[model samples]
Target: MRAEVGIKDAKVMGIGPAGEHMVHAAMLCNDYNHSASHSGGAIFGSKKLKAIVVHGTKRPPLHDKAALIEAGLRWRKTLQQYSVSDRYGVGHARHLEALPNNNMQSSLIADHNRGFDHNRVTQRPCFQCARLCPWDVEIGEGEFKGKIGHFNAGAEWLDTFWNLGVKGNATLYLAERINDLGIECGHFAFGAGVLFEAYEKGLVKAEDCDGLRLEWGNVEAIDKLLEMTARREGKWGNLIADGPLEVAEAIGGDAVKWVVHTKRGVPAMHDWRPHFSNMLREIVASGGMKPQGGGAANPPPDLKYREKWGPLDRDDPKGWPQSNVIAEQYRQFVGLMGGCWFAQMHLKPDGLNSVVDSFNATTGWNFTLDEAMLAGHRSAILQSVFATQRGWIADHDWQQVGQRFIDPVPDGKFKGFTIAKWLPEMVREYYQLSGRHEKTGRPFMNTLVQLGLEEFKEWAQLD
Candidate 1:
């Protein structure tokens, strides 16, 4: 709400200072986007408006259908009135298609600056409490005029929505989160593990790490190491942001090939090399130098390659194809609601359709399930084109996460199994089906324009 309102002292959970600063008009978190620790919205503020907090007792209803049927609609409303953010509940997306940023979009210019703040807020919300509240709006006195910006912290590794249910171990945390059955963030652990090994090998001594020991299997030590790395605390810390690949080259170690990163030196997930197709894509899509083009986080329900082998069992084969269809549909569902993808997973197709019905009842959009999928696919394709311009390819071996399955499972229930060998053919088939280039690994230009991304033709100079 503060973001939409430009309230300097007002803080919304899960936002960075960069987001807080770029506000003209903001939306407060409604029942759908508000969480126990966070709120999403557009904000506005005035010259003298230090803060504006609209508190309420609305809680999300419980997910138990039997309980809902027993409690009745009237009872659910009453329960919601007193709901706190901590309670477990699922809320559907409410399409607020009338808002700015294509119903809901962040300032691209601000996002880059807000990277640190995003990380900070994710790691610890306390950072916001300290500095988020106080800001000087340069707008002269007016009802809704001010240059607003908040003191947002950086991104936290655990701030990702999917990490909510996983165990937290610093050394293995990256691996767990990246390989989350419900989510996928591409391969990041290969580099993290390598860094840990480097530390153990005395490559990064105590002095390089600012007195912190980078021992293997020590969560505390790894956590401290990450903080230092994120903060750039010591000499090595300052250079650490260069990422594992660069670090390996600079330090003169045999770690570059194993560093497995996309363009920006961010390491590929643990399974980079073994999945050569993915690695190839990672290398190509990442500007052939940087390594950030790989997909960010994907929801658990979005895991498409469940058959390749992992700890989780497939819920139903019907869902395999249905799941993709649903996933595509859900994206459109979020666009209508003006919600983030991280928050959209809680609303499956059926649940989302219910919200659309509510919206039509209130505002009369008459949004249909088919319409939702079209919107999502259109938007997603645009994003895919952007990835292609940045160098996505079908043959990149380092980009995919399935490469990790080549090695036998070390200690899990699926131990000693190597699915890596089977991943390429499967992923390649997926690529072919998805309409990627056969040799260059880029998406077909027609696909880009088809997805409402005509701008890419001009951007990439493609005819």
Candidate 2:
């Protein structure tokens, strides 16, 4: 891609065989390792679009370059206080706590830890960013002899194949293959496992799976399933290609019980059973799969202007609804800044005050922290309103928190803790905080008016 662009500096963002075949959960990759995800690859392939190469040679106009740099430094300084940033070059921890193992069925990190412990990893920071988290790995031998990438991050690992019961360096092969094929890793991770469980319970047959015995940590069988899904080859491949929830529905009965998801979108990758606020965020907004922010001492949105109000106790389900409302506000606000929200999330200065300062400096505009938050709030409401139009306005529709997600953790630190009991009240409080009717999940007209979205009144109004 680099050589074909001639003298122009081209950044190629394209799909692979998965997107070309229009696999249901296909994702796009930018410049090789940088993931440009959100299940958009199939959309690109459907339109016969392959890759988007951006060749630019213009400098962005900045209102106050000096101030922007200063603000960035301040944000970085705060980010430096975070211990994880110090391990930037060390790559993702082989085993991080609370990563949700075996499709959220257990919390134990799989015992299959092998491969890549000896592979050298180096910091491959994105352009102009603090808290460098991206790592580059080049395989020297084995099945992944020529692979070049790292398997150490949430989106890369969790959303890819980590949560599906893989906990070893064998994750490298799955990571490389998923990107190579361009299918959604989460889709394969969740769908493959549930189907395996289905086979175990006799829900799926050997004939359906190309005669391969489905078993846990069967990398070869999993790999074949991935290939089949990407190519939509054979009956089982086409069946599971729609992802876990759809596959469960297709298989019917006990199959759906094993699938973990919210709104049929799986998760941003986290076991949210113990974290009610995180789950609430997804109920209101589509992929509120990210965990909460800041210390309990600071609370979220700790900008000088807002007061602390949230699920102060991480384990307790109380106050999560309120936290999610604010979380949605902050999350949507981050989205407005364009991708890279992951970088800005922890630096909220409390959040937004300094970042808003930097944004204003770059655009030469007068934007405030409140305005930034308001914009974020507006984005969440827009998604909520759109969801309502699609008959997703009901609390149950949003609360599709599958049995696997709400079911008690069979083992781990959160043993016996389940969101099942608290979910109803938590969802009710979320409605109150978001200013929506309890029965129908529609946001009130006044709520729309508050967000300056009175135009969506009819749509938000439910019969």
Candidate 3:
């Protein structure tokens, strides 16, 4: 469509999943992949036009949607006012507010939403399982005896194993055991759990484990892995700590490919590939974290809608579809703010659009959808500059829509659903709507220059 629309030259940019896709698609189209590093922006021409991509921070207050709305902000306006605080956290707010020359932090905060306080236990749901089971878990007996210590499953010896077989839900029981051990469960952080299960079954041993016991749901094993992870200890620990992808690569096994992650190293924890619809695009749009809820996905019991349309279609709020729309808008928001999404999720869906109010209050600008989209365009261009400078670009080196990625949901309830078969259409549709080249999957040169990429325009118009 970009070619059809007479958009001949432009420096294109993609960030997060969008950026990842751009890199892949550009490689496919042009047969190269060269993006800038995470820091510097790329310069395309003698004019020195730049494109930079800085993800929002992972922090609080700005992360909470309710607070953003309550504070009365639109997406762009909130980004402008709380740029640093939004991206980093409320803690960074002080740096932004300190004095005259400190606006750099403020600018960063504006590029992203504030992060959330994940350490605050009250903010999270109780993770404890209801039924009690026992394991011969070692506790600090003296100070923490029976105080709900890690792995309280007592030494009934084989009883736990017996129940596991009878219960037949090795996954469930294993999860419970790991949780009991106080392990942090993030995207596939339970890699240790799977390993522990294998170890108990004698499929793996201390020798196989690099001298550490891969005990069955053993808390000590978890502790060891955690410690190893912190220090990047040993070859095995170092590989696993980075993620299953690197682990698989180092181990020279198919383990990483089968571990279930996106093209990048991120684990597919939300189990997205199978869900039918453009929903998974949200995760694709996010670097890897499924914006709908990274760890595991759950249905929204109750969804409250804003009176008017902001970004997402508020009328239909389900899992996949609603999530896709929200994720796309979220991509736009975070990219423009150069902030992280960890904090963006904290803000309610409407919290961003309310930035209009915040803008009026702070900068005296009445922002509109057109203005917001333009900001999005500029943000995307900046991100492109960043990728180009980082040498993350190569002709046709973009992430391919893996048949497995776009096809069959490999590992969960929605196993048979195919994402690849349907997502291409969605991608094309997205491109069309955005006024981009359908074949190249890159925005036009005019669009780039419009978004402030003159140098990009010159290089893009090569020949």
lDDT of 3 by residue, 412-451 (tens): 3344545454445554554444444544535477766676
lDDT winner between candidates 1 and 2: 2
Model 1, position 72, has a per-residue lDDT of: 34
Query: Candidate 1, after superposition: displacement of residue 67 in Å?
Result: 23
Error of 2 at 333 (Å): 1.5
Best by TM-score: 2
- Off-target runs (Cα >4 Å) in candidate 3 are 1-206, 267-269, 274-279, 282-331, 334-352, 388-407, 410-415, 423-441, 458-463
**What lDDT does each candidate get?**
0.34, 0.65, 0.34
- Please give the clash total of every predicted structure, in order: 70, 2, 79
User: Tens-digit lDDT track for model 1 on 1-463?
Assistant: 6557665455443322211332211112212223211112112222323233654446544345553344233222222121212111111101110100110111011111111121211112222222121121122222222323221111222222111111222212432222121111221132344455566566656676566665543445544544444344555443443344545555556444334344433322222322222333344333222221222123322233232322222221212222233344455456545543332322232334444444344444555655555566565455555665766554554344222223443432333434344444533544444444444445566766655665566443233
lDDT tens digits, residue span 1-463, model 2: 6677674568888888778888777778876267755558888889999888887789878889999888777666555322333322212223223456666667654443445554556666667666565666665456666567653345445434556555454566677777778876656777776777787789888776677777766777777877888888877688666767887887788878888766777655555555555555544444432222212323455463465553367667766666566656666666677635655654355345667777877888887777876787777667766666777745763467578877876776668877677757777777766767765767788788888998888866554
Name model 1 segments beyond 4 Å from true.
1-9, 12-192, 202-208, 217-224, 251-254, 257-329, 332-336, 340-349, 358-363, 397-406, 438-463
lDDT of 3: 0.34
